[model samples]
Target: MIIGLYFWNLLRNQQSNKTAVDRESKKEMEKLRKLRSIQLTQPLAEKTRPQSMKDIIGQKEGLKALKAALCGPNPQHVLIYGPPGVGKTAAARVVLEQAKQHASSPFLQDAKFVEIDATTARFDERGIADPLIGSVHDPIYQGAGALGVAGVPQPKQGAVTKAHGGVLFIDEIGELHPVQMNKLLKVLEDRKVFLESSYYHEEDTNIPRYIHDIFQNGLPADFRLVGATTRTPDEIPPAIRSRCMEIYFKPLLPDEIAEIAQSAIAKLGMPESPEAVRVVVNYASNGREAVNMIQLAAGLAITEGRDRLRAEDIEWVVNSSQISPRPQKKVPKEQKIGYINGLAVHGPNIGTLLEIEVTSMSAEKPGAGKLTITGAVDEEEMGGGARTLRRKSMARSSVENVCTVLRQIGLNPFHYDIHLNFPGGVPIDGPSAGIAIACAITSSIRRVPVHPRLAMTGEVSIHGRVKPVGGVVAKVEAALQAGVEKVLIPRDNWQEMFAGLQGIEVIPVDTVEEVICHAFPEWAESISERGESEGNWIDPSIEPAVQPILPFMQARSTSE
Candidate 1:
């Protein structure tokens, strides 16, 4: 009976241990279930990102071109050029989805979008591993799997491999390192990424067929690349740029910013005052910035227990966030002496209305007048005055060119001390501001006022000719936004067609003389007098055949 009881006790112990194991397994699964139930909070920008192409704002033309490329039977690789926070990545993703619906498109239903920022991408130079292309994880690596640990090589798929038959979107592609970029270019040409490693042996008995296949035949990376960069076309490498179709996204206008703000507010199920919306638009330059400002304002309002966003809330948010208002210097209603409005473009799309002002005083010594320029820093030297002057070589050269033209036109630049200033201390880099600087100096020296409503952009030659400048369309748009009534561009830019220039008049002039005629009409009588006596000058507005010059004796006799 004791022997039977011993066996029974052992059986009872085994049963209890089994029951405990079952209970532990159930508890672990319950914990996992609880963890799975937890939800992640998404930012307002991501939550409000457009899922459909039609929902995207402020880039209708770009979207149309993108759609054509993505939805066509033979889709091409693309490069999206634009400023930050302008929906390049989001647009790329949505276009992929839309392409899947088109029967003619090559994209499959399961086509994926694998995105990476080149700014943060890590690459292995030895070809051991690459995050963009597939990498070979050798047996020595810690997580190379049990098979790999047992002296078999393993191939790890990367973004390029995973995005096969779909899109691989690289943000800030211009920031990519040259080595990695070369590897990517190779993949682009071959449509496959080859894996290589000393640890990988084809004849190994333990090697998986898939691993062997990957090592022998490169992994498929036949995916379309959609690269987004904030850089201009010139900044991008020629090889990559040549392979892709480029699309540019313009900077958001004030009205577009306002509309984006309203949409974001509605998505948050929050009410915002119209004035508050306007305030956000005034502070933000792009749709992304506008949405972020609105979200910040909404958060402040929510914390205060206010149901609707107030202008005061926006103001508080702006102050707390340190968001500066858009630089919109009020357009002078009346002409001002020595001050002229000049237009400048920052990048592909951003344009600013710059105010160039000139003031002159009699020099301490006759014929020893000096030209001092401010508001531009020397790029070569980072320190003070002389360096600053050197940094503004373009501006200085422009001033010298203007002086040459003045000397040619019978004005002595050395008779007075000339001080040129670009207000707000903004660096003047390009030659596009040449004509405006000349106009400002002439107005200051001649005691004439330049029309405040007029803004001009063109390069001024030493011969008083106005040379054509790039970004004329952008400059004119900026002038219109700044409430300027008229813009004077080079005659060569007259062929450039610009949309939304209804209220503003854009006059094309080939010479500084023509610009002065339009800008300083009050001095028209003086200009006519000078032109008549100076055989070199001709007023383009008059017929050349009608104005006959008389010989010295004949003219003298007629005057008597």
Candidate 2:
């Protein structure tokens, strides 16, 4: 009875152990089944995901290239280049969308696709290469003399091997180092696995070729390589760029920007107005920024329970996002001054040449004509501008001041008018240009042909003293480029002028009186011939340092 009981108890223990093992096994099998179901369902859903070419937006030029590559007889490897978030990657996604459609035919429906980030893949030597080409010693290759124990060597399948019939997308292609790029290029060229056994020597000759032999001929010629980067082609290495068809994606226009904003609103299911859309898009500058800002605004609008997006909402988003240029104060006109044209005389560093056109001329004398002045003047600062305008205005206010000085000098002209302009819309700011602008204006108003080759930059004080300017080198270069023959700079900048400064004569000036004297030599000579002593002659063009009045010009102001 005891022996029978012992046997029965042992059997029961065995039964309990088997039951536990069976339950655990069943649970594991169910877990695997769930995993398998998830794997099967994920790809099916991903395939059915809505993607269409027509709905794609931005990158018109890139789209054309993509169409040509995917639809043409010989598809080329493509590289999309642009600023960050300007749709280089999105353009690639669009291509993949089209490629997916092309691959859906009965013959090609099994085509596979692989997307890899070169930046992440570059760190792993084995990981990167193993994915593209299967490992040399894969299970199928082990313990084979001629072949594996199965008696036949099989080709190891890699991701590239898997992707043989379809496209491989590489994002941020530029981030790939030279070695990775070269490896990728090889893979792109030959779509199959090229395996070589480095760890062990082959023991048999007749195994029908190693599993690595599949990649011997290089990648399958048909596999497509799609690469996208934010860098220009010039920035990319020549070896990699040589294999790519490069395309430039330009910035979106205002209208297209608006469209993107509208699309974002629609995607987010928010009601937005055209004005609000414009406000948002213009604020964001690009599609990616526009979308992000719109998303934030949409969330805010929904959270606040607003039915329609108001301009204030957009403003709030724009302000909160800080996507706009900093606000600049509007300069007050009461504090504003006139801009002096520096085109007449070259100022040291702070001024530019003003070109003058005379429209009207009338004079007290038979040959004289009334003169008005117009042209462009470049200057550096508002303070300098104030002094320059004041000097020019004072010169203009006293017709006698100009006529007496010019006629005594015999540098006379009939009734004249002067019109001035600055080429780059650069506001002339400085007192230095007062004398130069006055000179150019006087030359036009006097109907005298001021030497066109002569260009000058300077600051004129209230009393007509020529003071130094800044940016002498840049001003000189500008003058030289503009084809000016002579650049008259303040004497102070003579040491600073570079030795290589070329193509023009650089003349230095000490005082406004000296420039005027040179401009009106006849007057200077006549005044000298007079027996009047130097003490008796008050130089009309002398600039005084202590003058309190500043000019009425703001040449440096950006907006006219």
The whole-model lDDT of each prediction reads 0.81, 0.55
| lDDT over C-alpha atoms for residue 295 of model 2 | 66
> Residue-wise lDDT of candidate 2 within 1-560, one digit each (tens)?
99999999999999999999999999999999998777332322132222555544555656887777755546567776655555655556566556555543221556555777767753335432344445444334435444455444444455555556666677787787776666666766654445554432355454445333443554343567777776656567787778877765654545666887787676655665787886875566566777777666766787998867777788888788677732111112221112322442222112234533333344456655544432232222224433733234332333334344443333444433323433333333334454555565555444444455566766654344456766666566556645666667777777654445677788787655566555545644644555323212225544434422121111122232
- Give the per-residue lDDT digits (tens) of candidate 1, residues 1-560: 99999999999999999999999999999999999999887789987788887668888888988998788999999999888877898899999999999999989999999999898888776656778876777778778778766888778888989999999999999999988888899999999988788977778767878888888888999999999998878778899999999988877778888888898889888865798888888898888888888888888888888879888878888898898887766578887889999998877666789889899888899779998888854443334545543353665677788887666555667888999898785677777888888789878887888878899999888767899888787788788888998889999888646434587998888887777768777555554454444233434444536754332111222233
- Deviation from native of the Cα of residue 353 in model 1, angstroms: 0.7
Which regions of candidate 2 fall more than 4 Å away from where they truly are? 1-50, 96-110, 126-159, 199-221, 324-560
lDDT at position 404, candidate 1: 77
